[model samples]
Target: MNHGETAYGLWSLVALNSTVFILFAFSFFKPATARDWRSFGAFSAFIVALFVEMYGFPLTIYLMSGWLATRFPGLDLLTHDSGHLWSTLLGETGDPHFGVLHIASYVFLGYGFYLLSSAWHVLYHAQRQHSLATTGPYARVRHPQYLAFVLILLGFLLQWPTLLTLLMFPVLLVMYRRLAITEEKNMHKQFGETYDAYAQSIPRFIPRLGKARLTADAEPKK
Candidate 1:
């Protein structure tokens, strides 16, 4: 470790970070179904793998030692900052954690958690009522929760760029997509035309921004 980077020989920090993130995510998700468990379990595994390499060990750094040393000589490959692969690859000067991408990563993380919480609330009530979820976050995007997870994962990747996380990212994305399709099939079977119309009106991943705002006078008199 160097002045620009923190030391990563501590085992406690690694365990703490991994536990905090995994537990925090589990709290918000409250996953129950087999599919949900698989998704949540996979997400937890990714998080664990990420922190493991980031603090406890540096497998990717070790694996790519030859190439990294050849490409950028005098690199502090063992430094925690060097684990930020984007900074090294881009030859970004100054602290990698303070770079634009790192700052933007925080934005993605915040928005993703926000979306996850909000979407979960709406989905919970809709599921309880056995009705279509077409309000709140659901009004703008069909799969806001999954998109939220994707954003969160992307944020982590941007900040850390570990090989394990990078590989897990695409796999989780495909899983989420398939899960969304299965969810849609169930919704279509239940709501039929109503769900079809709602699905058609709303985008799957991208939001419609402000188009979902309700007009105060649009509702019929009680």
Candidate 2:
């Protein structure tokens, strides 16, 4: 529980965690196109940055040490638990992993990967038939894969608040949004009126409640 001395400076742990997560996401995302690689690369970079600060350097804690020490005098900056900045900031004294933010992070991560996998399955089948992907997760949102990446990033941000990753988050969001727009254009070219109609009915990122759900034969996937 107390990783004060053994928390940071573990390069192996940083690499292990980063590789595991990046590979897990890769397996689900299966980046095939150049655009897909860009999105995957950005997400991989975020995972690496997060793990680097989490188990390798703890740069955020080092930079904010003085402030954190003054703010919470009894806080141990080097402890793994202290790295859960959300818990610390919220005055939660128990194990950071069991905290509310941490629990929510798990939910985000679990569902994010699940959504990513589900979206890929739908897209893959549709692509094989040279058709649009309008079923499953796509029916809920136009860009489920992009939304999955956002949720995953948000999950990591919730678990570990690092300055570098926090800055990268918004940049990734903008990048994904632009990519989504480009993809939508491509879909429009391919599916024409069908895609346009689906776009009108389905929301982009957020799911519209009480709205009519798109049928299996509805819109094209991003």
Best model number under TM-score: 2
lDDT by residue for model 1 (5-65), tens? 5567667888999899888877777898898899989888998888888888888898999
Deviation in Å, model 2, residue 72 alpha carbon = 0.9
State which candidate has the highest lDDT: 2
Q: What pairs collide in candidate 1?
A: none
- Give the CA lDDT, 0 to 100, for residue 38 in model 2: 92
Give lDDT per model, in order.
0.84, 0.89
Q: After superposition, how far is residue 2 of candidate 1 from its true place, in Å?
A: 8.8
TM-score of each: 0.89, 0.94
Give the TM-score (vs. native) of candidate 2.
0.94
Give candidate 2 regions above 4 Å deviation.
1-3, 215-222
The deviation in Å at residue 23 for candidate 1 is: 1.7
Give the local distance difference test score of model 1.
Answer: 0.84
